[model samples]
Target: MLKPISTPTRELVNLDGVWRFAIDSRAGAEPWTGLLGTPLEAAVPASYNDLFVDPEIRDHVGWVYYQREVRVPRGWGGERVLLRFDAATHAAKVYVDDELAGEHVGGYLPFDVDITDRVAAGERFRLTVAVSGDLSNETIPPGKIEVGMNGKKKQTYFHDFYNYAGLARSVWLHSEPKTRIADVTVVTGFEGATGSVDWTVVTDGVDEARVRVSLSDAAGAPVATGQGASGSLTVPDVTLWQPGAAYLYELTVELLDEGDSVIDSYPVAVGVRTVEVRGHEFLINGEPFYFTGFGKHEDTAVRGKGHDDAYLVHDFQLMEWSGANSFRTSHYPYAEEVLDFADRHGIVVVDETAAVGLNMGVVGGMTGTPPFPTFSEQYAGAATQAAHAEHLRALITRDKNHASVVMWCIANEPASNEEGALEYFTPLVELARELDPTRPLTYAMVMFATFKNDRIIELFDVVSLNRYYGWYIATGDLATAETYLHGDIQGWIDRTGKPIMMTEYGADTQPGVHSVWDQAWTEEYQVDYLAMNHRVFDRFPQFIGEQVWNFADFATSNGIHRVEGNKKGVFTRDRKPKAAAWALRARWRGLEGRKPGSDGSTGAGSGEVTGADGADG
Candidate 1:
């Protein structure tokens, strides 16, 4: 779907503020018919779980309601008005004045509802959105709900992240012309100094509405113009969008009527670039580019999974300060605002789907065995595969045109070692290639997926393995962990010729905890844990990157393994650096913020962090 933007023939209004909220006592209840009897005020664009003092509201297992009255602008009479939602967790059913308007499944994706016939100019109507946090084996991130002995329904999810619900992003009311540009696809490439942009425009109106497209440089000078729905535009001198330096060309598309009068005009800011995964190396613009970053989540204290600009800007600043150049959306698709910021700053991104916790075998990390098995009918069967496939399609369709996204991660730590792994994953891999072949595809593999047992690793261009050697495997024995980690990675080197990246590897360390001896959860131990992993990483030239398990500590489900939340982050949840952070800053800066690839020599003793000795934070 095309993102709603203000154009010459379009008007945009942000409908984000306090809204009347209530917990649903039963399913299929229409709260918009009358005022919700027990309505409480809640803020939009935030997860409702942590915004309340009551535990019932925080841990609710079912549906909730968010309603507000909106007025149609008087100037939007001739245009089509839309109810736009940037995101609604899991699923949302929107109603206009007590009548069902539109609905969408899958959170973290934008959708729109046409309300042109529901209200008139200068009139008011109740806009109600009923959102559900319910999940099942049929959902993207599968889960099971069971009623406890106390008769309260409890949700048991396989994923580690807390299930934050409600409108996690902004809501908007926008107006568009009768004939508007629906969507556009731009594939960019360059040869020598000249650049080529292969463009295609899709319209949603009368077939007779003519299309006109043009490209303009940074100074607003038109470089090329074409009169068609799809064609290629070439520039004499092209400035490529590099890893750290970015350049954008504004593409203006217009729809004209029979008399050559402009009816609708849409603007797109595009960056010309290309991405490829060469043998044992990931390349951008045909040059070897290393990735130095973390896997991130949209988490905060009170807001939960809410998307806030203040946190986003500060997080990027911290990443740059730490000498990081790339990041992954980890288990789910992040808000579009993040990618837009990346586009402007030229940050590499590994766009992932929310197909987390798909494996039913490893219930308690890598060693423990669960009673159930994955890729089966009772667990992640055909129904689960269908839902997972839907998310992949939606993810590519939404993020296909992004310049920052270099690859697609279909799943995180799936049970690719299971018996039916190949049968289950063969089609999904094909589907990803079918949707967008411009980028490579990979999935985060569990520790159980060995070279001998892994059935689906050969399908991917890059081998993205999430390993925990010192922390989860060896457990406080750094020397033994180093030998074990090296031997295990050597299996991959002997088996395949693919470029391998340690997508996740970290030890949970408390920020203030300090110890001279190497002790788990201490700041000093965290530093040593990272150093040992780096030693193993430098031994193999096929090891292309090392993105720590997390950018910052984040909230997770309550369990014996968690202390308040997951502490695997190098930075604290509040964005404070631990001792391990300094160790990474020193190493990555020395590597010029790129992972060691192609070079067999170990890079050490260079790019010192100077000030603090990294003994304590």
Candidate 2:
């Protein structure tokens, strides 16, 4: 469905900020059952784990509750009022005045329910949401709470990032006309300097509705216009969206009554570009485009995994300064505003799902041999497969219209070697193709698949590998890593004959630590690690992209091995750059006298590049 847009005729109220919060640790304690005892005030759109000081509150596994009172807009009478959540972690159940309004599974997508019949205009109602981070074997990012020797339980998952839970995104109360536009799907094509757009507009109610679609340039000049629920429009002399020179058009789809008076309208900023993969080449607008960036997470210090505006702005500026043109949403889809900003900045994205629960056996490290136990058993389970499909549908429905999303990564580092993996992924891949034929589909290959020739590689249009050779496997052995990494890339290229992209490759490094002998966790080792990988990447033309493991240090499970969080980020957790950050800047931005991989060999004798001279963009 189209995102609810605020217009003159529609009302949009943000229900963010502080809300009454409580934890329901008792079994069968339904937080939505309306008996919320004097709860503590906590910030909405943030992980509840990090907001409190109590260890129990920070480590609670069961249902966490949020309650708030909202007054419906007095002017929203006779309109279709809806409660929308940008996203809630893992699973959520919503109640309005003790009546169940909606429930949704999966933490990475938006969900809403129409409350028009449940409330009156200008009336105050109690809204409560029960958010659960509990995961079973069937759930994505599969993990379970294990009671330790000290009687303390911890959330152990296969994913490297922390499992931050709660109302992680925004919530809104939106009202539009009873008979208004429901959704709009726009597909664009480019021919020389002209652009053709095919649109499908879906609406609700029985009013005699007519749809008017208009495309305007960046300068507010009309470029193309069309009138229909499903039709095409052509704009002459269209400006194509290119890397570093992003040109966008404002697409406004309006719903009008028989009298031609507009009732509701939705405006989307669109970039006209085409993405395709042809035999080891990633073509954007018919030109090969190399991706150089990081596979990032929506993580900050105090907010946990909450989406923050300041962090977003800072991350974008840092990425641009590092000369990055793209990044995958890593293991899940990010906030909608991030994708919109990417469209504006001409940054390509490999949009992914939160379906990151494939590995259940090997927890702590990557360099382990395994027929890992199937905790989720998702490959053979029908219910898990069905849930995964629904999650994919919701994700595609939400972000399909964005121009920045060049590819769809269905899963990250799944157990491709598992018994029923073929059966599980086959239909999922087919479903993605049916949902979006315009984009390429691929999942990040884990080390298991990389070490051996896996049949699952044949299912993807583009091959993506997330190998940790030097860090996880070789343990600072770059020479041996070079051999393994090069062979792994060649195996995928020979097997699939498709363009390859290294989605995850980085080493954990303490920001201030320095070692003369290139020890692990030292800043010098991190730089050399990346530089070695780049040298190998340059040797193969089939390699189209290289996204480091993470953009910055982020919080993970409080394991015994972890110091604070995952220290693999080029920058520290607080957004300060490390030596590796400068190394990346020099290489990516092509600064004068800063040529990385000049020796094209991995050792202690590697050339040094500095980030000191890097200008803040």
Candidate 3:
């Protein structure tokens, strides 16, 4: 016999308005000390840059201190108070009433601290958070070494991206009952289309509980139901979800005590989609669809990565208008709002983990000391590898319900020559399969180093090649580049039956700049580059898709090719559209009614033809 589940009423306190802010140099500085008597001002979502008018002060790097006072509800005395941060860069030390509370390391992931113990009922509690902006080395995965900007004789390599260090995402206070659901795990299968949900319910009393699970469709119609013990429930005949026609199913789990009185209930939304790679073609619901898109960075000109909801909505609209049906959350996992937008907009997402820059190498130079010994150990130790596998499992478990996510990218541009990479990636691939067998696992392979290991390629369901041919290799030779790209992909297809996706390809363009010399900075050059790739894309049916190098021009600390960052966006950093925007729109809008593989198929009226043409520098 099972117990009925009860749902708790959740109240969200909007901590968005302004609070008091100050900059401190000391490591353990506590803002709560004088906060109670000091005057309070607007501080919500404000950046350190907002305070300084001087250029030097604006760019100064150190610790920024933020403080706020919130009154706990009189009736919410027994309830648990959770302080949640959507994101905090680098490192953060949280304090309540001058008492040290908790600390967090990673900048991108969401974390919360139980601050109930530190807060008094019906009284205003002072909360202070000190965040360090010291990015001397990449603390996260995919760490890099670079030449230090301070003009030190020694060269340093670091991760690329603007260090918009602060509370770049959001902060909130949530209150929940003592007896509630701690976490839930939902897994789907294709065999008879069954779904299972494991619930970890927390309670105070030793009363036996019953759980009732029900499934609903997008229209809120009941499709399946089941009853089970307090721990878990399995529902069968689940509706299979697919991209483009993403049909989401809602699961409601209710808890009841021994008296059969409902105590708490919780609901989670999930999509049942099966993804598989079969020899150079990706199958979604047993059909084929081309994945044309770009790599995304969570950066803007003014806001850096601290963008709001409107920014995300505009970015997605640009992708959809540009004929991009897919996007890679490049180098790291994006904020939850970004993923949520991707879900509703019907965009295919390759949810990449924050595991890039782990192995930074110099051309013709010997292997140097790696950044962050933690990552190095994780790459080398079996136990650490197992821990990384669990980290990936948590990521998958948290995001598996999203229909937009079709693939899980384990690592980005890891060292192909290093033996540790092979050892580390093999287990990750297996772990991804073990956790969620519904989706395929993939890693971005450097084009020049693909031949080093045939065994590594075997583990991936789809073979993704990141080629910067015309952009980096033969910058002036388009024809030779296309020929090489075509031949290389063909050879790989012959070797591995796994589907192929040109994971990355694009040229940098200075938005709004028009050049007659080579059109490199002009929108014409951007369109020409895509037109050339489309020619090759039309010839290769085995290639599943091509994601452009980037979706927007992002801030990079490391400048390459005399550019501060990769200026490869079809739009500027400020979300302004380039001339190439409409050109891409014309191409993706049903190929402009031109037959596939037909010469002069480009609808831009630029007289560009579909063929391999050589150009002299």
- In terms of lDDT, the best-performing candidate is 1
Span of 10 residues, lowest total lDDT, candidate 2: 608-617
Worst 10 residues of 1 by lDDT: 608-617
Please give the RMSD to the true structure for each candidate, in Å. 4.9, 5.4, 6.5
Query: lDDT of all the models against the reference?
Result: 0.84, 0.79, 0.63
Error of 1 at 199 (Å): 0.7
Q: What number of clashing residue pairs does each candidate have, in the order they appear?
A: 0, 3, 35
Predicted structure 1: clash tally: 0
lDDT of 1 by residue, 207-302 (tens): 633888899997899888887888889987998888778788888988888888888888877788988988888889998777888988899999
Q: What shift in Å separates residue 166 of candidate 2 from its native position after superposition? A: 0.4
Q: Estimate each model's TM-score.
A: 0.95, 0.92, 0.83
Residue 141 lDDT, candidate 2, scale 0-100: 51
Better candidate number, 2 or 3, judged by TM-score: 2
Relative to the true structure, candidate 3 reaches a TM of 0.83
Q: Which lDDT tens digits does candidate 2 get at residues 429-544?
A: 99999988999999887666643535577788888877777776677798877777777776666666788888888888987889888689999999999988888887677778
User: By how many angstroms RMSD does model 3 differ from the true structure?
Assistant: 6.5
Q: What is the lDDT of candidate 3?
A: 0.63
Q: What is candidate 3's lDDT per residue for 520-613, written digit by digit as tens?
A: 5567777777677767767656677778776778776544443856677878777777776777777777753233333422121111111111
